[model samples]
Target: MQFIDIKAIHAHSAAQIDAAVAQVFEHGRYINGPEVYELEATLGKFLGDSKPLHCIAVASGTMALEVALRALSIGPGDEVITTPFTWISTAETIALVGATPVFADIEPDTYNIDPKEVEKVITPKTKAIIPVDLFGQLPDYTALETIAEKHGLKIIEDAAQSFGAEQNARKAGTFGHVATTSFFPAKPLGGYGDGGAVFTADDQLAEDLRAVTNHGCKERESHYILGTNGRCDSLQAAIIQAKFANFRDAEIALRQKVGARYSEALKDYVTVPKIHPGNTHIYAQYTIRPKNRDSLGEALKAADIPSAVYYRKPLHQQEVFSHLPCAKKSFPHTEQAAQEVISLPFHPYLSEADQARIIATVVKAV
Candidate 1:
């Protein structure tokens, strides 16, 4: 009945969470505490340990992107290319860091930033590319990496929605020069409160990230760069660590099954999310496009079923970005997708009967 069923999720992990929190209370080190480092180490091992990826936990996903940009030295007079169809924070991070956010169109099928459109936007000032892993699926990083190497641009994987996804054999967070993910309560690997982390195999970059997130302190007495208070709370990290141990893998598998059920039942009535070859989608939002998106939403509402739109407007059309330059002359696909996509209630805890009811309502609506 709920959109994401967070209560059901917490019910499964409540005991483990209480234990973790009790340990936190016993120690009483709230900021950048032991639990935070434990979570980071666990995440590093989960992603890969061959090069031993460094994980830097932060206060929020937006702050993760901001810190990554700063560590990479991307700032004023530099241009960073990213998609126009994502949450505003993706592009806003670039502008906030004093860089220009160059908008690129997305692939109609996957709703990912088109690599071809990215090449057309490169100029002498272009510095980095932030390819968002939208809707729990990753962009074509192999193609994006080729483009970055040829132009000497840094690639930052905006993996806010894809913490548990994979491309080929590489985990989503291991794709670009540095990748970031959110722990917002609705995300696949969410925590109790706002949280995020940056991942990298580069040792020097890891050092910079740790320093920048901690008031730009290379050491307690030495301040070297401009930074912010971006450390992930100890309690949030403990809760997430507990949740991951209890149900993360099982939940990921359940998401795939749920996404497939939605696609099989609804593909005839609307456009289902497309998974590129060699990629595994985690279904953060099982978005679909119908010709009559608004009407379909109303019809489902009338049936006591809820539906929501992931994005109703592209960043290019937003008034705040009117002053920025765009990479493409037109975002035809991005604009078209905005009017057609809607998401039904999707959570791992949904019963088959509930899923069937949702499907029946959607089929009847469309």
Candidate 2:
């Protein structure tokens, strides 16, 4: 068994994808073409925004975050409040922008950065709050927005794993000043290769992002500002457009159903994820904590059922960030969760039999 059935998904979308590639090859506009625009437009609608939000294509999710911070002029000496219970990319981007990443503790249940803890971490240097939507569930955005307003901080939703997530009747990307999603093959809405986009209600920020993605070029070759080569390739965009055409909603539905089965079957053996009220979980990983994570993962592997960890070390405890104030102090919850959480096989194509086999193996191991 596979960790995620990416091969099965590719098989299902092969014909449509071939056509998309053929069109791109025929046109020879392999840089940025109609396919790129179509992808941006289709995903904007899929995101379901009211005022025609903007989507700026980039090469990767880390590029999106770096550009967003650069657009806001957040750099050295500035701090971004965020939880440590996330992938290193969350803190890595903050540091790469020459800004300090302020650590905040997660709520033990939801594994989301606590807004109250965020408020405490904020100070005069706090320029942004980057609450990650870890494992495809939206964080407490309503509370986050309130905190943002109170502190006069820009909220950038680090939505790398939550492309289809929702909370309190609003989509994940629609919650903050801007949101970023990755198109790495493992994500809910992914591309054939490295791809990403930034979502924003502000038109000016979108324009800036577009230029930033292309070496600060305003047009084909007109340099405007210092920027990186972060443009999304047309081939990747074509694959994304093809995937968006038919399987987007169906895949989301399948994920929800599959996640429910995991919850029902595994709750007795482990601690399932806890989502806040009025929130929708997109089940990107469907991670749970077995008391003996490493042993359980090994047993599952021996049973031909693969399992992995979302993260091994919380950012606060990572050696690279140990000098920062927030990283210096203790974060018990984030530390504990990092050691126990294991992500089992999850994908739209995971069959009921596959799930049953996985569950049986896990129950037996635990």
Instruction: Please give, for residues 175-266, the per-residue lDDT of candidate 2 as tens digits.
Output: 78988989999898877788999888888888887887778878877888667888788999999888875566588788888999999999
Check candidate 2 and list the clashing pairs: none
- Superposed model 1: Cα runs more than 4 Å off: 49-51, 327-329
Off by over 4 Å in 2: 220-224
> What TM-score goes with each of the models?
0.98, 0.96
10 residues in a row with least lDDT, candidate 1: 321-330
* lDDT of candidate 2 at residue 256, scale 0 to 100: 85
Q: What is residue 61's positional error in candidate 1, in angstroms?
A: 0.7
